[model samples]
Target chain A: MINPHDSVIVRTMSRMLIPLIQLFALYVLFFGQYGPGGGFVGGVMLGTSLILGILVYGRDGVPCRAARKLMHGDGVGLIIFAGVGGICLVMGGQFLNYSSLEIPLADDARRRYLGILMTQIGVAVDIAVTAISIVFSLSPINDTEDTEPSRD
Target chain B: MIFSFEIPLLILLLLTAAGAIIVKDLISAVLILGSYSFVLALVWAWLGAVDVAFVEAVVGAGLATVFFLLTLFNASPKDTEIRRQPVPFIAFLGLPMLGLLLLFAAEDLPEFSDPKSPASVHVSPEYLEQSYQKTDTENVVTSVLMDYRGFDTLIETAVIFTAGIACALLLRRDSK
Candidate 1:
């Protein structure tokens, strides 16, 4: 959906900003234990970056294929979350009993940390995919018939 | 109460809310609503509810505003005139009754951050005391959300997933 008539300033600025936004989102997701950020906020930021990309570059501006995959992979996060909980249950603890995890960590507390981190990652993935998918779904598709061919 | 600062903030919030309702243009109303959310977030943060404030800032002021703008763009651009509807009898009479009941109930609530408060004396203290030792997480909010209340979070995630899917199904034009 690239248009030759699109402004150069927006395209250039967004290209630079999008990567920084995604990086910050990742930092928030991983560093949530000691900070104010978490998976939900990080995921929203990531989704906002993708939405900005779409606004600047159009539907095809962001990686369209990856976006489609993310849309379908929305369930992946929940699966991971539930899977971890199920594993804990099978290991003779209650559901989501992270202390029951048989990780290589030195103690139960460490294992709990690992479990929480894993769960946060799952939440981040789910939220990010959902946000992007919602934006993609709601965005108006470009009319191919009326649009002129790309000049590039 | 932090009344010195809170009074002004509450006034500003009221103004923004009123402005949002009174504004004729839909876009203008949305912008005002965003401002209202921001003010509300600030008030929440001032009251030491940082997590709630963060969610309000992100979801209310950020994502919700963006979604509203997107929906606005999809619809025909029109200056929406606010039409005054007749106030229902229940709203006029029952609302005041409800408000009075709430005010009466508020008398029994523990003082703000009172050590002897039911909330402080109950499971909250245990959660605070044990969270770090049990979960190895310094942030009590994180420990509580991801560990103690994981089932609720899982359900919340499922709801969000369902919303995304529903939006996609309803909006996407089928490519034949």
Candidate 2:
């Protein structure tokens, strides 16, 4: 457990900053088609924001229910990616054949764009959740130490 | 390439690499390594590999440094002094031999941006010409990674997911 009273400045600042960081991550994920950002970069940023929150507020800062949900969501993300590929296969194309999807798009190119967008979102969600899970798994022991009475 | 700027940046990169290895403290060494990654990202950006540079900046410098710091904290009970060890004779001989071999290999490599280079002369031209038309994406890197080589990216994601699972299992075991 973290002493909520400690490091008030950092806590307040992180509270303001985490949302902004998450927004930037989403921008990176969505705008990757036209720029030097992508699922990997955006996902890492999202994870880092959560880690920053953990640093300031401790593990308990992240609600247990939320963490559990996110952990399960990692698998859901992977399934979504695979499901898209399966859809392509069922549509009489090879795996991950994005243009095969019959979206109400103007052309094959638009379908491809939408397919890529969906896949990128899945990848981003998977990576971001995995990153947070790794950080959470690693940090809990340290958190316990902080909460316990110091021997020295 | 801006020769004047590139030269100094290259020098800074070398200095950071050396500092990272030579620094006595583990924490300082990790920080210096992060700096090295940052400078390398800048160099990559300068060379117009913006996507690669972005990955380096975010993953290598940012998340990796944080992970290293966390691992360092958890692994050690206290701030243990990083002892300076004498370089082994094999390392001195082996590293230079490896470097010399690479230098010799470099002789056969085409000059940077040479049109006739194997890289530029191959599928790269086709990819550059057709990526936008085929994928409706302006970013070639994204198209290449996600569309052209989707399986590879999917596998990479699987690997990361496995790593997260492994970390969770290991850490949870320790806690219990």
Best by DockQ: 2
In model 1, residue pairs whose N, Cα or C atoms come closer than 3 Å (at least 3 residues apart or on different chains), thus clashing, are: none
**TM agreement with the true structure for every prediction:** 0.88, 0.90
- In candidate 1, stretches whose alpha carbon ends up further than 4 angstroms from where it belongs are A1-9, A63-66, A142-152, B77-82, B86-101
Question: Highest TM-score: which candidate?
Answer: 2
Which residue pairs in candidate 2 collide? none
The C-alpha stretches of model 2 lying farther than 4 A from their native spots are A1-5, A62-65, A141-152, B78-81, B89-94, B174-176
- Ten residues in a row with the worst lDDT in model 2 chain A? A59-68
Position B29, candidate 1: lDDT: 93
Q: How does the DockQ of candidate 2 come out?
A: 0.63
User: What are the per-residue Cα lDDT tens digits for candidate 1 across A1-152?
Assistant: 22322888887888899899899988878887877677777778887777777666765544554566667788788888888899999989989989998887349988888898988888888887888777766665645535757557
User: What DockQ number belongs to candidate 1?
Assistant: 0.61
lDDT string for model 2 (B33-152, tens) is 999999999999988899999999999998999888887876765555677878998998899999999999999999987999888887889889998988899999998888888999
lDDT of 1 at A111: 86
- Residue B78 in model 1: lDDT: 49
